[model samples]
Target: IVGLPESLHAEPLETTTVRLPRWVGGSYCWAGAYIAGELMRAEGFTDVRYVEADRSVDQSEWIARGETDFSVNFPPNQIASIDAGVPIKVLTGLHSGCLELIAKESIRSVTDLRGKRVGVDGFNNSRHMWLTLMSAYVGLDPVNDIQWVLTKDVKPTELFIQGKIDAFLGTPPQPQELRAKKIGHT
Candidate 1:
């Protein structure tokens, strides 16, 4: 991406004369993937379609529906999709260790989450799935040992701030926002 002129970035993943995949989604976490798509378009892949997916699970579903040729997703969601027979395979991992689980002072560690309420936008979403793996990593039963608090359309951070949830694993801007407010410990 070095010296990639500013103007080129303005029109990333644009539909073109050549097609890479019918549908591909982007997450803010992986800007490189988007850049790759842009480069492909620059190289004459004019027919590549772009999709905006808020969560990796959505990307998996789009793939299952034949609306997406490829996508990037977390391993837990990827495995779940495959187990659910989504007919997609992992080409490679983009990255990991980006999820940060934040909690109030009452909760000091991952193990402390047992018998506690954790917030998520919904079940099986990015936050919930990541938190599930984290719970298992600490030898806790994700399904039974912890209470999953769903905010539904409401962002979990709001619930976490209001003390409705004991903890939440926010991906990016939420963590930064929480840090600025000095609201929780991560």
Candidate 2:
């Protein structure tokens, strides 16, 4: 079933457990975990298990242990899991597209981001990769020019709102929310 963790659905479904994919291909890694939990509870799944399997190898471990009945994973990861002898299936496509880099102030253009601190939710994820690509396209070296602030607990939007981070690399709502708050011009 298609679910959003941050969404508020009135009618909850009847489910016992919920599992999320470790990675959603081009979008982001582990980005759907929270939303999957939200979906599980919203669907009335009392037992929610979040499996951290970024690749097929990790997914195999979860299946071998019988830790979860289902998981949200990339197509390649899913294929790998199946190849590894893990009984798993694809429910549906959750998300698509790469992330974007958003700045608190008016960047005017990508060139302004040079030497600026860019906030990334995680390393090696879509956001991180997007920042790297954006930086290169803008003639900035992600490793040397832009400062990447890796945050584990707080959301990138939250950091942007609080002014703790100059730029955030992620999907919508955060950028839209920031525009709504008049904190930045998207």
Candidate 3:
């Protein structure tokens, strides 16, 4: 009943068709989707399937192109995809208080980031979108005000560890990992 529609509640217990559910990150990040899928299966969906994608692939594109039935991602990225003609719908937010912008010891506050380098997965991805928004909120240009480092092959955590970037915006495991190693501060 959690993720199911009211229309589905009264439907007969029979074979139903659904596009494969897709998600990003490891099991913990997508645990809700998996649990919901399993619940649907228990409720008599005989053909439910899930498609787990690698981090590098754009999971939103999977949903946009109809390769997936549903997925969770940063709201900004989803909105960008919708603006770009992706026929996807945002159901709801799963949780909050997970995303954190971390900085090394030398960088004490947001204002300290002027002329500093920040690392993100890509130039226009979800993390980068937030970074840009935050920069603008602080009266920074988001582009010319700070140096943006692309962490395509290398992750933000690794980039921070290697002293390649001054700050990084990361989520969940990355934050946890950084904390475990005492890498940065939020």
Candidate 4:
């Protein structure tokens, strides 16, 4: 799930739009429709509808209700959706590489994350997984060593700027924005 706000729906889906996700499968399949709409525009199509959903779950809901055409999502979630009887299809993997563990201060290494409050979009997400892997690598149990803060609708950069979270696992623009604000050091 991209975690874009619902406000994005008012905008049209056009060739200029780009949808981001780790892969295309499961409940997140409708995300591919957004990408396909973009491709159609690039091929000279126009007036296409380009709308961004809040999360993979939202996309899944849209697909199940027939309100959306496609999406991009993780394999596990997709499989679960299929088992639950949501009609969907796979397209292709958009990108790879797991999330990175980041901190708001100069921590130097993962070991420094002990006792830190880590912020992630949600549990079982790529960001959360990275935090878990990093924590385990440092001999810290993710469930016990750190306080995990799940900020679902709020952007990680905003949480970092507000000092609501000590560290976060996030993707591009948010991490880049953090650097621009000097709110944290990855």
Cα RMSD to native, each candidate?
6.0, 9.8, 4.1, 11.1
Descending-TM-score candidate ranking? 3, 1, 4, 2
Against the hidden true structure, what lDDT does model 1 obtain?
A: 0.75
Q: What is the lDDT of residue 170 in candidate 2?
A: 60
The Cα error of candidate 2 at residue 145, in Å, is: 0.5
Give per-residue CA lDDT, model 1, range 149-186, as digits (tens).
88888887888888899898877788899999999989
Q: Against the true structure, what is each candidate's TM-score?
A: 0.77, 0.50, 0.78, 0.52
Can you tell me which runs of candidate 3 are displaced by over 4 Å? 1-8, 13-15, 23-27, 52-57
The superposed Cα distance between candidate 1 and the true structure at residue 116, in angstroms, equals 1.2
Estimate candidate 3's RMSD in Å.
4.1
lDDT of 1 at 163: 85
For 97-139, candidate 2 gives per-residue lDDT tens digits of 5445577666766677776777886775545765677678878
TM-score of 1: 0.77
The window of 10 residues in a row where model 4 has the poorest summed lDDT is 17-26
Q: After superposing candidate 1 on the true structure, give the runs of residues whose Cα lies further than 4 Å from its correct spot.
A: 1-27, 42-44, 52-57
Whose lDDT is greatest here?
3
Greater TM-score among 1 and 2 belongs to: 1
lDDT by residue (1-186, candidate 4, tens digit) is 389653344555555433332332323334455566666665555555544444556355566665555555545456556777878776654335434456767666787777877788888765576578778987988898888888889877777778787888766556666677676787
TM-score quality measure for candidate 2: 0.50
What is the RMSD of candidate 1? Answer: 6.0
What's the best-to-worst order under lDDT?
3, 1, 2, 4
